[model samples]
Target: MEGIAIKLNKNISLSLLALIFFLIGLFSIYTEVFSGIDRMILDYKFRHLQQEDSNKKIVLVSIDEKSLSYFNSNGMYWPWPREFYQIVTDYFHESGAELIVYDILFDTPDFDRRNLSGTMSDRRFLQSLKRSNNAILAFKSTENEDPAVDLSMNNEPLIEHYNIKNDPPYKEPHLLTSKPLDKFAKAATGLGNTVMSPDEDGLIRSIHLFDSLAYKGFVPTLSMAAFLELQPDTVSLEWTSSGLRIGDQNIPLQDNGDYLINWYEKGGVRNGTFPYYSFQAIVKSAIQKMRNPDAEVSVPPSVLEDKIIIVGASAAGLGDIKSTPISSLEPFPGMEIQATILNNLIGNNFITQPPTWIAILILLLISIGIPFVIAYSRPGKGAAAIISILFAIIGIGLALFTYERIWFSTGLYLIMATIAYSGSAAYKYFAEEKQKKEIRSAFGQYVQPEFVEQLIAQPNLLKLGGQKKRLTVLFSDIAGFTSISEEKAPEELVSFLNEYLGTMTDIIFKHSGTVDKYIGDAVMAFWGAPIDQDNHAELACRSTLKMMQKVKELAPQDTNIHSRFGIATGDMIVGNIGSYNRFNYTVLGDTVNLAARLEAANKKFGSNTMIAEKTYEDVKDVFYGRQLDFLVVKGKTKPVRVYELMGEKSDPDTEELEKIISTYQKGLDFYLNREWDKAMNRFQEVLSLKPEDGPSETYIERCKKFKEEPPPKDWDGVFHLKTK
Candidate 1:
């Protein structure tokens, strides 16, 4: 039986290990073939963990549909004059706005300039830009292309102070800026590129922070240019191994220096995710506030005060909109992306993936641990465990995202764990089924079918080595069976014994106890092995009491056959024992011997049940019993307290039984203290409570004998049993 179980376990273990490797290989394939799903997982995580934003320090002065309609109704054309933007600029400047960033690029001069000559509409916008202390203009860049306009001295402030090593090349090609019109560019405080590149999935998740030029060095993007203008003096840029650092904040980057933009808030042009004001409204407010300095302006001066303004086209045809992880269905305006980027940088909020080695370690750990958990747990329990691990990984991912601003491929690792658990559990089911068949075949005759099933479920129980464990062992025997067997026919005796053993075996199996063996009209069993039962002592006592009840129902009325039981709880070596060819699962050591001795001792007191001190301690509160005596049973040197287990705490007549126990305890105490006369009287008192009480009657006899022959001075309370 032991060998078969060991061999089966080895097979299951090998199968589980193979499944682990298969899961890892599957994960590799998943990442390579289904990479988009990974992004989908990231998007889900981002949206799920998003929090509401209440502050609006940065605002957008947008040329939205409302502004377009308002302007066109007042006779302004679709390409509203640059002079209108100049008025918006003057409004923001006078309203105490900190900085203005143009998301719209002015790559060429205004087309209607030929008709309106002396001081062109473009020149008016240029003059307005020159007067502002914090106005930044936008430009564009493309691959292998140079600027259409001339480079000016004004863009020098936009150049980075430190140089970065473009190692292993960047993901995107390096291109120089196509500067805005020379006159307008020179008039602005700073120049930044307003170029955007979408991900392969057509979602704008990252942006190029610096455009590496062929000879003119690096230029900032429009958002970054605005940031530089905010901290022109205190901020110093430096190159680092991971990315570049502006002051103490590190800008994590892809190899090509494109930054993964952290969308600090959700996107909606009118959702107040960021403050929004119509471009036409700001221009009108500037005129209103200037005309009547004390007038109550709808676009209040306090609203734009100290705010960094982003100027962008939000009209359907004018603005460039891109899909994002959060706004996957409704496109996100390009200017909102810039505003989010600037918001992220100004607050030093960034997200990065863990190092490759850390990610691989997490993957390996989850994959390896999952299969082992599934292998050891029961089917339903295994599924629950795997699900718990799945959520734990996701929780860790969310914590990383929330507190550390880090993102990991938690979804992929979770897939690896799930695949490992499911595959290994499926294989384990078949493997255990084979083990169960072999167990039923090999040990069916030796043990009950229920025990055999348990052994199969936990195959480790069938190992050949013994483990010292605390168990409750019981020994039961029919009293005076020798005389009955001699008088009865051989066939009749065998039938009676089988009937008795079978009924007892059923009772034991019903309570989840393992039946060890039968010693001819005697039965032995134990609890707390094959499966760990913390309440082993209580279970053993309960089973013994039930077995006592069951025997009466099975025995004939004419027969005087009755069973005696002894239960002891202590450390014993329990396991399969025998040669490799044939083995029996049983227990050994002093605890077992004491239990057998206890069974035979029952005959001396005419009692049906006896239990050792260790068992009593475990069940004192729940089982009704009294300490019977301190006895040195055969073979042992130390004295042990023994008691009779009457019934469970729920037994009827409990109050009366308790009163009888109290009187009996006093008798035993007096007997122990060598007060023979007092002990005799107390025992007599116990008999009055319940006539023919076995323990009290036995104690009365001992007290009378002690009175006649007083014990020697060296005599301890322990009664040494000379016979077993």
Candidate 2:
């Protein structure tokens, strides 16, 4: 229940966060278009340059890929009412009385696009778009639309899209934006079209079809080069109104009243001549070093010298941005509609539109076909959406950039994909968190509290395997336990031993020791690995000392037994050492055997605890100890110097034992010299001070034997015990 509750809470929190992002995505759609219009129309001066000596003559000015970088991390923001606007447009207007067709929108008038305050009016910019005999300005038809106008434009059909590799079939790409046909009509005596072309992920992907206007019963876009380039050579025709004559070419309106375009193919690896001018640099050049507000300048009469100029933003952040055909770097101002119109007029080239069947096929395949693929794709692969969106956007952009009129869509499919991916990810996150909570709660109580945590953090460690390590093993027995058991009733004896063993075990565990087993009245434990400790020797000694004090206290209460402890230190295999069906975390080595041997030795010495030389060597400096013997513990060949731990640094003052220790050393030296009678005399002296001496009794008996027949002449004082 607790795990479930935790999982539920986490899922609820993540769901709320996902909902917030979803709403933000909806809101973003509306705001994105406003930001985009600025990018579309920055240079309205140098556009519509196909018609010479006409009131509609204009030049083409590009905001270009470079100008878009103004919105980069280090860009100068809120572009002021700089010389860019004043010089380019003002010069053109001053030169002659021509119509100013603005591809730029003046929706929100601000002095500089960067700063909100302390700037001048862009009314000067807007008024320029509105002036002259043939001036036309563009705006959207989405006055009553939602934040973003998700207009679906009627498309020209797709042509061939295939490859040799076993690739997926083609689909119709979505439209970027609906062109405001009504607004276009109001803006120009000769209309310029406006479109918002979106890529697969709702990014602007490209400039739309240019030759679209030549189809029957259709009007041309605002961007045709012929419109600006040909005055003598180009003809202007009104539907059902007038016959047209352009240069040496004469055109008559068809019965359906649409003009056909004569297009020339420009093959791969080369480009048709499209002259580019930087809007920022040109505006700077126009205003630099000019003294007079109205200075007269003359230019040689040429195709674009007297033409109308259109300006627009081409920067990605400026919002007119589109993933382009040539690269993902394509962009054009809203004013480029005017430029495209001029380009078409000059070249007499136009795009061909496919029939309704083709449109239906493209739309059906893209919307239905792509979604089916996306829906059926394995949930594990997130890049399916990315690759789908990229291939579609880049494919369509390259097609348009290459002048292949394939009905392409990128933006709409991306919206559907975002919903799919984000929703799936959020759901999975909640599910996985729940699984973790379940595992945590399941084994929590069955294992040691920390063990469960370790298992959860690293599940692989629970496998049945372990490594060898150096360790200190201890064995302890209750001194005189059999006599106490015989004296007491069964209930009393069992209760007494339980209380005694329980206390000792607590101390061992408290000191980071692992309890190995219990033998009737004995305990086996070890320290230093089940997670290694650099101070296993120290910890073993410390646990041993604590056990002695605790068991001594146990003795007075129980009156049944006193504890005998033995400790030894050496390398051991420390881990789960048991069968596949049953297991125990334990330590085993020669050190363990010796520790048990030392416990039995404790009985011989009449001491509570005895440590082998291996253990004493590790901890001698920290405790008050005496060399008890130089005897080989059972199961060992070499006689080892063992010690009896008198007390630790914290044990209450041991001045008396300090004196006994000094006397014992003297007595021990005398006994080792083969003078049995002399050794007996010194042992008898130690007994005089402490009557119940245990080690001295053994020395006295050995002396008595030596007095009768003496030890071997080469006896080395070290007693080598042959068994463990």
lDDT of 2 at 249: 37
lDDT of the structure predicted as candidate 1: 0.78
lDDT of 1 by residue, 185-223 (tens): 777877787777777988877777876654457777789
Q: Per-prediction RMSD in angstroms?
A: 11.6, 17.9
lDDT of 2 by residue, 452-526 (tens): 455555444433345567788888887777888888899998998898877887777677776777778888887
The Cα RMSD in angstroms, rounded to one decimal, for candidate 2 relative to the true structure is: 17.9
lDDT of 2: 0.53
Q: TM-score, each model? A: 0.59, 0.47
